[model samples]
Target: MQQPLAPWLEPTLNKLLAQAHEGQLAHALLLPLSKEQGAEVLLNRLLQGLLCLNGNACGQCKSCHLLAAGTHPDAYSIKADGNQIKVDQIRELTSALSKTAQQGGARVAIIWQAEQLNHAAANALLKTLEEPAANCFIVLASAKAGLLPATIRSRCQNVALTQVSKAQSRDWLQNQGVDWNTVGWTYDVLGGPYAMLQQQGQERLEQLQSARKEWSNALAKGQVSATLCQYTQDQPADSLHVLHWLISKKMGSILASQRAFANRLSALISEISQVRQQLAHMPSVNYVALCTRLVLDYQQAAKQ
Candidate 1:
């Protein structure tokens, strides 16, 4: 079933629906999700609106029924298999798109995490995006659009989802009875309350707090190995995000003598950013080694 759209997103949806009504809807779209937004949720909502008999995705029509059942002939989705979206996937999609809609209604295709598309895959898909099928809407969504190939991006209209105010996000989450402890770290990874809701539980909250403290103490005492050891394969990305946010936040508290290390700090930030990219996009990486090297590098840089 389609979920309710976030309030902050309503305005954006309204604008797009208006364009859709006016017959100005672009066949191809590149949407970069706001930090902390659910990429899947946004994609589904957009697809719902596109496929919905009514502009609002009323969820009671034949189209909505097919969509909910995952058997909609005109509805298509492309997602990463493991870490990459292969060329074959794009080929299959393009082939299917060439055909007429089975239900004789609007057709919609959404590529989630489009940055995961490999070179061949992106190029293959770019051709179709340049001249998409009539009555078909293709939406490409990613957390970072820059990671996608320039050619593929050039052919799509861009829609960047911006973050709502922290206060507004807090109120919304509260209304949902969400139990996101700290509430602030909900902003980590550009995630919002809905994302943090997945991490609820006093036990999980305590674990996160302990990890954050460990990260802080490790940096202070130069316990790089021990801190790096804390990162598990199951949640390496989340752990790294917390540590990065913590380190960045504590950078301002450096001693006056360490103020001259600003350049080094900036460099470490860039390195952390690169590491994040690696952890997210590269498959089969030894995260332990990567985390250890990154933390030790930051320590050495801070001392210099």
Candidate 2:
């Protein structure tokens, strides 16, 4: 059985289903979501609802069964190839959309990480977006919708998925039999309930704890540790994010006499942000080197 939608996402799903039933659903929808949101779960429920023969995801109909089994011929998906969605992938999806639905019902297509669509891929999809086939719907999901082409954005109806509040998240986590006190810092660093849940295994928690200790020691000794470098090298983006959070927290506790040190910490945080941006756009960048440089800079900053 499929898991229920997160408390925060249920309303959005219901609204979309209502629109579909009223024949007011747009041909193209753009869903902008943050990393902590459960985009896949919401998308699965939306697809099942849209393709269900009964106009509701009853889960008893043949369409629902096929979707559950991942054999729904009318359902199609496009994903990034490595770091980009190429033109050929878009071409194939368009060709598939042009064909009749194998189940003689609505056809649905989902483009995951839509922001990763390359220039040519975005151009290739415009015709289909403007002239969708009868009973066809296209859904584009992206964390960075601003990276998508203006033409693509203009052609689609926007669907905003809001983040869950901290209080709501804490309540949900408690209901799941988790102790929020243990994972609260992880949640703060990750900034989402789902992200915290996904990343908060005992082993990961230990690694983060160890990294924090090493960071403090490095600051006092004015030298970065091998363990700290390894942690950053293993997951460069996440490590940098954690480091950024740590620096901000440390800055808050600095004495008024340490204003110069706080300023240095602020500069280090900005540098980490820039490195993170580079990693996101250029996956091939030497992350190991970047991690070393960031940790080294932090060590120097601590020397005041």
Candidate 3:
């Protein structure tokens, strides 16, 4: 029989369970999950199972019931307020950890979008990380690890989760009662299950497809200013993906196209890399303006 969670969950949970079984689980862990993977749900189940008095998640004990009800006193969470995680939030979380475990079981702290932690917040978190409490576990979930501070990153055991194959995603969608035919743009835009659910349904998918087509066409025409303003309105997080795709396409065309644009492909690739690097620090920059400038710079580079 299929497990309660996604198939990919097995490899990750199994590794953790084995470690916990052998009493080797580290105090802190960093789970870098792909954009589409449901890290939150998986972590919940893992925590519930970990806290259950029984070896298995009987879902009957007080701990399991509290977890299912989302009232587990030992479980803590911190998420980005806007583009950044403030220092105050980190302080609050650390203070919460100082208190003894509510049920005298393992205490857990989960940080969502860990890459959003600013310098001060990250530093504050590092203090607790350097000296974790006994029987306490800290789980930081991130879409990408490079955005995090190197100091904080070095302390945690890193677990990377990649995108599930297209076939696996398609099958999962089918099981969720979604027809593959209806998944045209949603599937492509989301790249996996959680995103599919977030961006699902009829009207939204249509809008995404329309936005993508228009953006692609404008980008190809070297109309940078108009495209930038348009993207400012849509504000899709996949802008980096679009830039990379365009660069790849232009590079592939270099061998055959007599378009007479000398070193144009090379310039585009350079600009894309710079913009992508900048995107990782969005908390510190005016993101909309930066995106506009990136498009303008890319167009200027192409013309040269």
Task: List where candidate 1 sits over 4 angstroms from the true fold.
Answer: 1-4, 33-35, 81-83, 179-181, 202-206, 216-228, 231-234, 247-304
Q: What are the Cα lDDT values of the candidates?
A: 0.75, 0.82, 0.72
- Lowest-lDDT window of 10 residues in candidate 3? 224-233
| lDDT-superior candidate, 1 or 3 | 1
Model 3: per-residue Cα lDDT at residue 27: 83
Clashing pairs in 3: none
Q: After best superposition, candidate 1 residue 254: deviation in angstroms? A: 7.3
Query: How many angstroms is residue 111 displaced in model 3 relative to the true structure, after the best TM-score fit?
Result: 1.5
Per-residue lDDT of candidate 1, residues 183-263 (tens digit): 557466536765665555656555567667766776777665544465545567667777777767656667355776766
Clash numbers, per candidate:
3, 0, 0
After the best TM-score superposition of candidate 3, give how far the Cα of residue 35 lies from its true spot, in angstroms.
Answer: 3.5
Ranking by lDDT: 2, 1, 3
CA lDDT, candidate 1, residue 73: 87
List runs of model 2 lying over 4 Å from the truth.
1-4, 254-261, 278-304
lDDT of 2 at 120: 94
